[model samples]
Target: MTMAAMAVLPSRFIKCFSLSSASAPVSTLQEIASASPQGVAKVVLKKGKTQLFKYGSPMVYSGAVDRIIGRPPPKTGEVVLVADGAEVPIGWGLYNSVSMFCVRLMQLEEEASREPTCALNMERLLEHRINAATDLRRQLGLPSINTNAYRLVNSEGDRLSGLIVDVFGDVAVVASSAAWVEKYKQEIEAFINKVDGISHINWRPSVDILKEEGLDLLQLKHASVASPSQVEVKENGIRYAISLEGQKTGFYADQRENRQFISTIAKGKRVLDVCCYSGGFSLNAAHGGAVSVTGVDSSMPALELAEKNIVLNGLDSERITFLKQDASDFMKKAAARNETWDIVVLDPPKLAPRKEVLQNASGMYRNLNALAMRLTKKGGVLMTCSCSGAMTQSGTFMRVIQGAAAMAGRKVTILRQAGAASDHPIDPSYPEGAYLSNIMLRVL
Candidate 1:
């Protein structure tokens, strides 16, 4: 940023933002100062786009940028200051040259004033944010005797955008999506390794996402060595075999509360769990005294794990059975045979990863829900879920379910509406982080 523009900002703000004087470690201090000796690069925003970010939106899209001002242009994964049209510093963030998200704002001007030591110091900021996240989970009573698997850092929710950390037993799986996170992989690992009860760290990079952030795929692969292939964890007093290489961070800890709810309502009920990854809902249902539980999935490996979990928990295999079949196919045949269950749990994978495909995905969700509803006995309960952030953020998932009920010739009333568990906190500024819509309905 130019000295004249810097002059326009408050004196206190400037002092707190001065990288050279930041109370950071010497090595990190030198890196920040040397990276931009002429002062940090400034990302000038369009006139009308300043307020959204000023009001605490973490993502600074390329479309919002009017122009950039710096002697040597800032490279991707570098720290840069974000300024308004008149060149007033609104915040500072990690810059990306190729991605649609030009900048991921780390802290606002007010935040810097409060914690000046972290200003322009990514290392210090990471430590502070991660420690705070760890403390928050402790406050939420995570890693208790009954549950040791849960989300530790929820990307934007934890103020660490493009970074998700799920802790399972003694291992922590770090999912990196942004170029900056990749750049600071070692620093992140070092901090996470220091967390209590964590003995191993697994680095899982989002290949497609990093590619969009202008990263080299080959280098990304060698970022970290392999961690434990599998981990045994307990959730809601139930044992689970978590495969690190399975889906996103292995187990679906976000649905912990929702699964517990299933157990509560499964007593004496015949429960059918569609797209049951690793038999989470099915196991809960069985534990809750379900007369019979059927778990269906397309993944053979997932089903294998699910079956193993049934044996692990010492539950009656005859009472809870798993099937390897497509969700729609199983529901269709069950409905055709006039076979219905007392409760149906449909937790589909992300059907709409992006907003552009939401229209097409809605049809898929509707069809699945219609089939699920059809296979539900009269007055039976149906717990449906959509992990698509686009669908959940669009606020039309309920409408789609309603349309599905109309198609199935069934009347549905919502018994409950929920999102991810408490551990997966959502930042109001970034509602996109709010995925996993779990709605319970009474089908008639």
Candidate 2:
């Protein structure tokens, strides 16, 4: 059969079995029964469609398919079908019965094939995605530090969909956000070990997102956690002890470069690190010869950990002080008290998780930076950061900071523009991968 004929026949048959004409939802069994052997056979003849067998065809019906089609049987797969206007094969995806993401496409075929295997090739896919990430890190000249605490794989950026793995020295933190990836955790752990120099692996399942996916959340399953009690990792030559049980994978690896940048200009200066989780920047500044450093955070546990890290670095405990207070509130109070600082660091958590909240999040960023600027001495450095991906675009975040500086009657000069560490490589195709945006401004 012709290629066009091959594509159309199976698609039509799969559509027939996969969906109902009356617009009613279809069950898995009904979807399978509706599949025509002829349509399946025709599509099987077409080349470059070998991987379809791993994931069942739309005609075969699966739990995922049933979830997409809310009601039982007779609904048309055409509801979520994406057709190539010209003679391209029809693409098949799972339809959501109740969620906003109504469809999740799985395959594109010229004709329906009854190979009974339409799932993705798990082993091959994993190898390809992992290697791609590894190659990118190497290309960027990373992996040289004594510490291996860097992101090894970043979910959709690596094309793995819902898997994120971070390497901290000899430990690997494997966090999964998808059911498919969770099912293959063992294989992923094995791959990390095979990469050499990796000692242990910790699994952190996506409890929040997994709950949304209607799956049971799992805990941190590790073989053994014994690489080091106070693992010393260097960021711009300043040492830090990373605790695994702490925040996202134990450390904010993304601020590695930015913290180092802060150290360069901190000599003989008094610095304030707002929202300093575990004092990542505070310690870096103190080590860089800052006369005194103050860290403000709301979490008492995090502040305690920050103090421990300060002691771990052999710095004078008196040089670094921690305050348990909200970052914005503290900044405002410092401004009211006229407590000026030679350098100020504002690194806040992600305020906007989605695009819809971008406006409110931008206003928050503006107000926070404005307060920070008001407390900064003339010619002093103000290093502000936004981890929220929604705020990192070219003009979006810069404008927010600019508005704050203008309102504070300060002329802000950009000394350096920084982003996440080398390990979190950004794909050219995915600009969103550049989530952490740090700007060093001198408020004159």
Candidate 3:
């Protein structure tokens, strides 16, 4: 990152890289910018921040940045090298001046020991991380053996924060959250196409993430290719019809294993899948031999797909039903009618988008869980989940559910706990990456 290091670099290689290989016609300015580190800047971090980076952390907040080591700091989405106290290279990251989490680190030299494929160039770094991540999934027997729909790239979890790629059968949905990733969209798309079995690619913008990072879309122009709007995917032998316009990256692939777990225990029982987006769990419950299954969701489009999923699986019509209604209203009504279910699932949308909403989100969790507890039959199972990572402080989510159980005059015991499937591995350094939290409880 020092000025002296620039002296040895060749001038001809300094030009921005072409969007495609030598044969294809070169196009797009942003693509070229993201393709090469022609003018990557340098950033110096404060003393304590170096330790986190040393331990393989991928995010450096604005407060952690001490000063610009060079004459000019990089623009939003531009690459930058982070220097330590003694000007040692900590790693390279996407520098976004506007974002609170300013630097989304891409490569760290310290990780070279553990991650042998780590590299310096932006393009090489992405390719290295993508290959490593996919290789890990293959090792875990992910899409190949278990489910075709799975999380391919988990942002920070895969050493690429602010970006998430979910694979649904032959389709891959690229959900970009950070401003830095906007520039590299085309390159990332090209890399994804290289992976086998990925014929179609869809671009689903993570507008909420973009807004949270305070990234100005005008400055960070994005590029992508067109693909299908819907695709059918198989999970543990159950087929689901998913829409590209639906929830996060089209579908919640994180719950792949959890749905299968529910199926193993759903035999001959009445199951209630609350906030069952696209009926993943509902379909699994019915396929698992549930006596009756009811799925509740507010999204008509999702409910329509969920209904389609039932027929796609060839499940009996009388054994499964889909309801387009608010989860809370349905739960309240079910309690009023004294309708009991052997197993009740409460997987609501992210209640706490950020730390600021943690308290309110906890309250929502408590109330909804209380309603779910009241609706469950005695000795039944209650599967509660929260995708809000900021709010799930170790046992905070379970504590909230326990508090709700106390309020509802019910006794609940933790039977099983689970989270994102193996594909979504959590880096010990990045606690925030542990977004999906699911716990099964036996209610009395």
Task: Choose the strongest candidate by lDDT.
Answer: 1
Most accurate candidate by TM-score: 1
Cα lDDT tens digits for candidate 2, 75-190:
22112332222213244443333233333344444322432243223555466568778778667655666345678897655655457888776777778765555656677877
Candidate scoring better on lDDT of 1 and 3: 1
Instruction: Give the Cα lDDT of each candidate.
Output: 0.92, 0.68, 0.82
The list of candidate 2 runs beyond 4 A from truth reads: 1-120, 138-142, 216-232, 393-395
- Angstrom error of the Cα, residue 425, model 1: value is 1.0
Q: Which of 1 and 2 is ahead in lDDT? A: 1
Query: Per-residue lDDT for 210 in model 1?
Result: 93
Q: Quote the lDDT for 180 in model 2.
A: 52
TM-scores across all candidates? 0.92, 0.72, 0.87
Error of 3 at 380 (Å): 1.1
* TM value for model 1: 0.92
The runs of at least 3 residues in candidate 3 whose Cα sits more than 4 Å from the true structure, single-residue gaps closed, are 1-40, 111-118, 211-215, 218-224
In candidate 1, which residue pairs get closer than 3 Å at backbone N, Cα or C atoms, i.e. clash? none
Question: What value does the lDDT take at residue 415 in candidate 2?
Answer: 90
Model 3 TM-score relative to the real fold = 0.87
Q: Which pairs of residues have clashing backbones in candidate 3? A: none
